[model samples]
Target: MIDIFLVPIALVVVLVMLHAWFGVGILKRGIIFTDLAIAQFAALGSAISLGYFHEEYFYILTLSFALLSAFLIAIASQREIKLEAFIGLLYVLGASGIMMVLSHSAEGMEHFKSLLASDILFTSPNDLYKSAIIYAFIALALWKILPKTKGFVRELLFFSLLALTVTSSVQLAGVLVVFVLLIAPAFVAISLELKKPLLYSFFFGWFFSIVAIIASYYFDLPTGYSIVFLGALLSSTIVLFSSKKNSAQN
Candidate 1:
């Protein structure tokens, strides 16, 4: 039992650390759906590969679609128009595109379900190692490169690195899992106004995620969706109840 779970837990630890950082940035930007939209596009690329190309150029197509969305969002961030709406549209577009692309495949629905949230309980060690390597580079870029840059170039780099991260994570953990990991912990940290929000996010994310993994194993539930459900539920509950209520004074 311990051996089976160690790799997945390690994967989530790495994922939470990297994603919590990006989540802070996303909350500040007010474009909450950016990760989902990019992740959807990445999944669309994978769908295309699975449907037509039989999984050829999987990484290239996935990264291409993800980068395309990031590029568009970077350009849109510079504009005066509504940005979240644009991202929402991109999400629907990618989602619809995925369905259309996978329409003819025999395993279409299964593919769609997995794209939304993979069964990460059985994720292999090799997958974790590759993603860890990719995430290390991304973390370095976020810490060193992102702060020193300015203007559209900075925007592009940030989103590009996010895209790169999502490209691998979407494959490993699926889209909804990526979204929750990116948003849930950071949302909690921000909502509570923690001094060390990033550190808090890491702790909070790891707690819910590991618990979800354990719960899924015992309950025979889907691991990825379990994480998403528990994370969303806890984050929302905590934020709502812990919120300051209005009081009237005489």
Candidate 2:
């Protein structure tokens, strides 16, 4: 049992660490659904791969679509229209496109479920290693190159990196897990007013995710849904109490 969980736990930790920082940026920017939109595009790419090519070159296809979405979003950020509405439209477009692609397949519903919530319990070591390598480069670029850039260049780099992260993450953990990990930790950290919110986000995310994994193991629940449920539960509770506290203080 311990051996069975080791790789999944490690993968969850890596994902939380990489996504929590991005969550902070997204929260600050007030574009909370940006990751979800980009992730949907990646999922659309995966669905296309499943329906057409039997998983051949899926990663490249996913990354390409994600990057294209990122570029378009970055460009749209400069336009007069509301950015959040535009992003929401992108999300719907990717999602409906996925359904259309999978409409005729016998395993369409199964593929849809997996795309939304993959079986993280069966993640391989090679996937973890590849994700770690990609995240390392993203972290390096964010820390070094991003600070030097300005305006549209900075926005493009940020969203491009986010798209890349989501492409790999959706394959390993699925779209719902990716969205939860990207948003919940950051949301809770900000709600609680932690001095080092990113660090707190990491701890909060890892703790809840591990507990969810363990609980799923014991209860025979779906690992991905377990993580999402526990994450939403805890984050919502925190936000509720925090808001009440602020209301009382005022």
Which residue pairs clash within candidate 2? none
TM-score of 2: 0.96
lDDT of 1 by residue, 62-130 (tens): 999999999999999999989999999999999999999998999999999999999898999899988
Worst 10 residues of 1 by lDDT: 241-250
* Pairs in steric clash, model 1: none
What tens-digit string does per-residue lDDT give for candidate 2 at 145-245? 99999899999999999999999999999999999999999999998889999999999999999999989989999999999999999999889977754
Measured by C-alpha RMSD in angstroms, how accurate is candidate 1? 1.7
Model 2 lDDT at residue 47: 89
- Local distance difference test scores for all models: 0.96, 0.93
lDDT for predicted candidate 1 compared with the true structure: 0.96
Question: Could you estimate the TM-score for every candidate?
Answer: 0.97, 0.96
| Candidate of highest TM-score | 1
